[model samples]
Target: MAALTTDSAKTDPLIRITDLTFIYPGSVKPVLRQLNLDFHQGERVGIMAPNGSGKTTLFYLLMGLLKPDSGTIEIFGKPVRSEKEFENIRKRIGMLFQDSDDQLFSPTVLEDVAFGPLNLGKKPAEAKLIARDTLNQLGLEGFENRVTHKLSGGEKRLVSLATVLAMEPEVLLLDEPSNGLDEETKTRLITHLSDLDLSYMIISHDHDFLYELAQSNYTMKNGQLEPMERMHIHYHSHPHTSHRH
Candidate 1:
């Protein structure tokens, strides 16, 4: 297993949000209020929030998909405020949406996975190679020619993740990544995620999944984020049995 990175080095944050506030159009209540966060390199951050608690809204604001009513968002030490500014940032921050259908639209699995690299200006062959490698990384070998819409819900979710990973982003924002997955698929997802070196913020309600991978965890409530106490988990492995407590 890869060693989890700690914030002991005192380096600048990879991404920062300060005094951020946002309210949806025509809505009086702000979904997010004075939100602040700092994400460091190689960190796995977990966010737990109930439905409609503004977790997804926070992600959109970070991606510049939704404009903040007030405050600032900085990525890679640069302030991002406009769509033009976010274009390059988007290349560095890959997001996996809550719904697989929202992310995958290509006819074949390979095309869907390769789309990001292709759009990033890689040649078709190079993009295809990246797509294949990403799929294999997620234990999806030989799924290249599979019909995108015909895949099972779990398969589609993994393929969606492959699409994001193909971009080789510096940061990842995963929303509800384990929503429709069974226990076996979820464990597979955790294993794959644990192997990656990239920094990511995962929004999940599954405590077990978050506990498995997140180095730091937070709870979102009333438009604010509060750090959660880290739970000490002990892992035990035996023949045909694996569990954590």
Candidate 2:
């Protein structure tokens, strides 16, 4: 397994949020309120929240897909506000949506996996090579020519992951990656995810899966992102913050 990077340990935060707030238009109440969090290089942070708790909204804000009504977000110590700025930052950050169908469109699995690389300006041959290697990494060696629509639910998920991995992203934002997998497939997915050499923020309701990957955990409650455990231990900075019930 590759060693996770620690460049941000003695340097600065890779992602920072302060006093963030947002609400969907026409909604009576805000989905997030005064949220503050920091992510360092090569760390895995797991987030848990009930339905409609704004986990997806948080990811959208971080990616600048949705503009926050208040507060600021910073990536690599710089503020990202516009689509161009976020697009530049996105080169380093890859996102995997909850639904596999949302990501997979090509007829063949290999083509879908190579899509990101091709868009990044890699040569067709080079993109295919990257796609092939990513699939092999996920233990899907012979799936290159497989028809994506004919794949099983677990296979689709793995192929979706392969597409993201092919981009060689520095930061990964995964939302409910294990949603519909059986036990065996979930186990395999966990094993592969645990071996990646990068930072990630995973939002999932799978408590056991999250525990296996996260050094620490947080959850959204009443629009507040708080520590899941009573001790409120944070892995990034020392001096654990205060806990709230």
**Reference-based lDDT, each prediction:** 0.89, 0.89
The residue-by-residue lDDT of candidate 1 on 68-181, one tens digit each, is: 999999889889999999999999999999999989999999999999999999999999999999999889999999999999999999999999999999899999999989
Off by over 4 Å in 1: 1-10, 232-244
C-alpha RMSD in Å of predicted model 2 compared with the true structure: 7.9
Model 1, position 218: C-alpha lDDT score: 89
Q: Write model 2 residue lDDT over 70-156, tens digit each, in one string.
A: 989999989999999999888889899999998899999999999999999999999999999999999999999999999999999
Q: Score candidate 1 by TM-score against the native.
A: 0.91
Error of 2 at 104 (Å): 0.5
| Error at 54, model 1, angstroms | 0.4
Candidate 2 — worst ten consecutive residues by lDDT sum? 230-239
